[model samples]
Target: MQSHARGHLVYAASGVLAVHTERGTSIVPANRVAWTPAGFTHYHRAHGDTDMRIVFLAPSIARLIPEHPAVFLASGLAREVLLALTGPRNHDPAAPDYSRSARSRLLRVLVDELREAHEQPLHLPEPRDDRLQAIARMLHERPADNATLAELGKTIGASTRTLSRLFRNELGMTFYEWRTQLRIYHALVLLADGHDTTQTAYACGWANPSSFIAAFTNIVGTTPGRYRTSRRTTARASQLPTVLKSPD
Candidate 1:
């Protein structure tokens, strides 16, 4: 996974991803588009053979987003705008010199669409459960850490048996699986932040890069390098103004 930061925007895109947020985890399909706001650390991996698109925007583009990771509705128009903005054709012109002003115009339009796009809750809040809240916070803050059923039971003032039952009834997944997903989610963020997969794997608590690669490919449908390369190539191809340098 490769991610680069440009201005206030850190765009990370992949195909068929499963996203885990503080509230919960869900799968993102082609019909659905996903993104996280600036400075909001989140993770996603491709769920199947798919192509993902991400576009980050500076806070100056919109005042509505204050501080939080959010998912926005990629309306049909929004999708079209993103495609056009990222297309290779945007960089090409028949003139002797590419116009910087034209490239800026396209980027402006792309940013406008992103800022105006509708927001959605990829993960909803849980019922009034402070313990769950604590667990969620801990996971987001440090996804590598694991709590056994007995440990969590003691920490949350419940028994292992009870905690097991609650996890099934409330969270809908076993503790280990949930933790794995959380770590994987955060790993994606690290990867998108320009952290190497090997470092991300170690930092996110994977046994090794191979293990991380296995999980990443299985869930994100592509390797981290492929994902980052695509995003960079798309961003550069879409926004770079055509320039001609005459022989000196």
Candidate 2:
């Protein structure tokens, strides 16, 4: 989880993975992958039985990706390339020269695939100021806390104006916007943990399920029900037997 000299791509063939870095935190589901540039201090946590795969990139290749941590949609080709690189068949130290050449080609393909993929809006930027951090910690611990920004500011010994400016200048988002993003992040985790929409809505501070669905869909690009269903489907598929003989 510590910073490395080489950048790496993290993907989960199933389940969810959260990557926390100085720049932000990325929530990566089965269909997405996260890229951490070299020399970034980061850590990861898996939400379920994750089939995690990682590929380290040389400085030259890593430069092609973003300087900051990012999340991208894992395309079909990208997934295949990742599996090939991390699969046991590709790990022989004494493999023939041709095998090495094949691996090199696959690595290039993987980088190219990532370069062309669209980035996902799965990142949650962290606050830097001490007061903002205090407010963030409180909300993170209790996502359902519906305190107004003015109310939260008073508790943190900062006026509403100061807090608003800090949120805009430091986080590049309004306080409300930041809170909504945080709530959505928590809602994603809860949903992945098998909480239904109504339960997730209340847990994340949404007064109504409809409002939660709207916000979740806006940020995650899918409704809560669909997202949860997709995760379950992927889990089931991963658990299926590799070979099934057809009846004669």
- In every candidate, how many clashes are there? 8, 0
lDDT of 2: 0.82
For residues 1-248, could you state the per-residue lDDT of candidate 1 as single tens digits?
A: 22223222222233335554554454443334554444343455554333555445445543445344445545555555555544445444553432566645655765565567655333333323576666767767877665576876677787777766766778677766666666766675566567888898888878789988887776655686775675455445443332212112
**How well does candidate 2 score on lDDT at residue 137?**
96
| Runs in model 1 lying further than 4 Å from the true structure | 1-32, 35-128, 240-248
Output the TM-score of candidate 2.
0.88
C-alpha RMSD of candidate 2:
6.4
Error of 1 at 7 (Å): 28
**Alpha-carbon runs more than 4 Å astray in model 2:** 91-98, 239-248
How much is the lDDT of residue 7 in candidate 2? 83
Candidate 1 — worst ten consecutive residues by lDDT sum?
Answer: 239-248
TM-score of 1: 0.51
